[model samples]
Target: MLVKGQCTICGPELENGLPSTSRFRRLAQDNTLVDGPSLTGYYTSCPAMDREGTTVFWRDGQLLAVDADLASHELFAMDDGQNVMGRTLLLGDGRVVVSLDSEVLAFHSSLSPLAEGPWPCGDANLRGNPVMS
Candidate 1:
């Protein structure tokens, strides 16, 4: 989930009996801190997950893709000088769509195409229902 307030906290947790939680920090290509405990409201974009459990989100002008464990990850910098906000859409063909400050952009996501049924984009669906496909 996309966490706001003092910092941008994004991670995953096991939902079963023994629940475990982990928080990750956003780093630049040079491995420098981009957003974490030192920053406030740095996570400006929404998150989307594919059927295979790969997750995608944005932070500090960069797109982040991570596995379900929130371990292995990749980052893509947006050089268009715009920040992404609102919801992110995962297309049926493995494309991630988001709206920038002044335009719309689509990125080829590492995630697979969405499932056949209704898929969760971010926090909820268009009807504000918390159902997962």
Candidate 2:
């Protein structure tokens, strides 16, 4: 539930701090988000399904790790340790959904079965849904 002018965790702060011109930095400057940790896990652009897609990562709500950055805590990019599963579904008209299910953390979206929806399978929703497997 990211809304303008609200202080949410927009994403991980870069290891070296964001550039002055970065949109996320501007958002922080505008008081849209609080300065937060560089949560463990690398950042990746969401699938191009909507106008306001996000950079995705995995963070369980209970893991309040403030000292260690996400980059130092996981080996996801090397594929040497835990494997991560993530998916994104597009519901059309700027509705993009992201799911990270390694161990099922705090999921915020509602999911319909593949067989049931106002969005039909094989339609724009299916084709445009970007999945990060």
Candidate 3:
């Protein structure tokens, strides 16, 4: 299914997961390594294998969403904030990528989610509105 933006470029889809690492590398080329307080707390000092975190994708410096590391490939976006800003491309491999104004970041996904629903604020807004005012 197409995302919520007008299409600027269209290409054939892929059957396998990621066709090439180059695709990821290219999308992440301009994205800088994320660093800051709000993010650092999500990661730990554990070894790679033991490390767990969520992979974040940013476009034009705005956070897209934290990808849920599950077989369902569920994506958890901030319900209170602006929706994903970049143009989304569904890869043939079934993964999604954003174009233009984008960056990608990762952190331990093992951290138990605080609560389910839209925004981190609470579940009250879940039934009322799409975005917080």
Number of the top-ranking candidate, with TM-score as the measure = 1
10-115: candidate 1 lDDT, tens digit per residue? 4332132322222345433464643332211244455665665565656557666665444546456745556446566667776777767767778875578543
lDDT winner, 1 or 2? 1
Flag regions of model 2 displaced more than 4 Å.
1-9, 14-26, 29-33, 43-56, 59-87, 90-133
How does candidate 3 fare on TM-score?
0.19
Q: State the lDDT of candidate 3 residue by residue for 51-105, as single tens digits.
A: 1222233322333333222111224333223333433322223243433324433
Question: RMSD (Cα, Å) of candidate 2?
Answer: 11.2
lDDT for position 100 in model 3: 32
In lDDT terms, which candidate is top? 1
**Candidates 1 and 3 compared by TM-score, better number:** 1
Q: After aligning candidate 3 to the native by TM-score, how far in Å is the CA of 85 from where it should be?
A: 1.2
Model 1, backbone clash pairs (residues 3+ apart or across chains), number: 0
TM-score of each predicted structure versus truth:
0.55, 0.24, 0.19
- Cα RMSD to the true fold for all candidates: 11.5, 11.2, 17.8
Clashing pairs in 1: none
Off by over 4 Å in 3: 1-74, 79-84, 99-133
